[model samples]
Target: MADKKNRYNIRDHAATYWENSPKWRRVSMSIAFIAFFYALPFLNNPLVNTPGSDFQSVLFYPVGMYVLMAIGLNIVVGKSGLLDLGYVAFFAIGAYTMAILGTHTALNFWEILPIGIALSMVAGVLLGTPTLRLRGDYLAIVTLGFGEIVRIVAVNIEAIGGPRGIAGIPTPPDLFKAKFTILDPKPYYWVLLTFTLLVIWMVRRMAARRPGRAWDAIRQDDDVAQLMGVNTLKYKVWAFVLGAAVAGAGGVLYASQILSIVPDQFNLNVSILILACVVFGGIGNLWGVILGAALLAFTPERIRFLSQPRILVFGIALVVMMNLRPDGILPKKKREHFDPNWKSVEESGEGEIK
Candidate 1:
């Protein structure tokens, strides 16, 4: 019982697992990380693209998609505290953008991808501008309606595949000019992983600067942030656009990977699933979101050996985890700054320091 209790302790491991690692080890870890992601798709390893190795595909590919989706949703829901529940609309926008262009036009995958991203960004701006004044539940409701509207439009419109949807979408054109197929999951995983890395880098850089602080301020208190002269609307819109672009990029990769897309694919369920990943993971923490998405996405496969009640078990585990650590699996590390007079209290770690 004690061993099990220790194993499930969240508070003790609030910091990163590798925080104590030496500099040399950290460098080595970084290099290995890059190689693993880059080589996984085409590497000849048994778990890679080998003829019989579909396990990695089944496990990691969906995890990759969810990771991208969760990371995107994090910007809006985590950073700006937007409470958006219609984010999958942007995903559909990107997928359909590629699907329509690939099937109806003579464009290649590479050419169609940019169009999809741009359209998704446009959709973000359009959605954000109208809902700028709304807050909390109002914002959530509007986003939910917007997401449904996007799906309904796709269902009713025939030119963009309609209810039956588009099919025979082509795979991406790689630099080697090699013909690719969706049946082969390696290329799709590699390409999507590359975009995911790029998005992470961009988000991290933005987070460390003024834009990051702006979003933080808005999230903490929008009226106060505005009182301090910050452009809350602009920053909120920026978050929306950024999240949409990430989702758009992921959607393009997904459409190319699946080679087929229907309106129903980007419904409310996907949005909620992505949101659950963000909430389950530490909101406002990028790595937490990634890990959360991966854990949730891959848990079903990992628990297959648990037999018939795997889903039930998974649900119970999640409920218990949240009950124990409502902040998330790993909440963002927050420091409490104290006024000069409270120095003694801060040092002693006693009294009301905050």
Candidate 2:
């Protein structure tokens, strides 16, 4: 077994890797550059609207949501080594909760935000409880089933508008109750941007704590983690809850931006799309997941002219990626020096390795 001090030393190095990743700097700069220029359309710049493009506003919606979802899933699949196929249910629940409670009913947007969180947390617990006892393929199957169930329920439940879903969701309060509505989407972009950054920060913090270590232990080997006194059930649930919270945040943001909710929007396709982002990007790397999400979200639109063949191309690309770089384009954690018995000065002085 590795010494405890040695493990801490390794964690310190891994922490430093996150603090010093050039990948983050590149991604941050790219986002800033895009944001700075994306507003040209709002400026009514005719040049920004190439021949027949109506995508000045709607384009950013997918980008924002994908980034948020990828970051959220990164917490579970990347950091904790849990394969969650039904994560999209949380997003659906959040969006629908906000839609129903924040609109059709008398509750306001601000009032429903807490409800969204609470409902999502409860959903997370409910989903996690039944699956944590299972591992790997079984857990994946359970989550997939859960996602299907949610989508089916949303479509069949008449109260939530069934397959037609709900529309005309209320927008957030305007600036000091001004005349302008807050559903224009540019504002939502900023909101999601801020939210994404917060999720990343929280993920990094949680992934560096004792709970994070427990997750790692379980991921590496649940049996070993159990032998080491780590409560696999507790940590597994933590992963699900945290991941669900991020998804819920995305959901609320989606409702605020689109001002609508639909069952079709949160189907198995959504789950597969998010999982593809995480898998293609590199399981544990948040930035990679973000990159994957952006690529998958943006590329399809870029080549829509090809129609059905374009999807084939995307599938081919994924196949190539699987064949060529199965580990993913950006791996969350890289191999580092693994010294099982590296001693600190204090430890060496006390001869504690015995």
Top model number, lDDT: 1
Predicted structure with the largest TM-score when compared to the true one:
1
Off by over 4 Å in 1: 1-25, 39-53, 177-179, 304-314, 336-354
Candidates in order have lDDT scores of 0.79, 0.75
Which tens-of-lDDT digit does each residue in 1-354 have in candidate 2? 223323333334655865777997768966886676445336554433323334445445566688788888877787777788898999998999888877667887667877887788899999898887886767788889999999999999998899999988887776544332543556666666778877888887887898889887776667778999999899989888988988887898688767777898898888888888888877777767888887786666666667779788988888888787665776544442244442343255321111
Task: Kindly list the per-residue Cα lDDT of model 1 for residues 139-209, writing each as its tens digit.
Answer: 89899999999999999988877988999887788756545675567667767777888888899999889
Give the least accurate 10-residue stretch of model 1, judged by summed lDDT. 345-354
| Global local distance difference test of model 2 | 0.75
Worst 10 residues of 2 by lDDT: 345-354
Q: What is the lDDT of residue 293 in candidate 1?
A: 92
| Residue 212 CA displacement from its true place in model 2, Å | 1.5
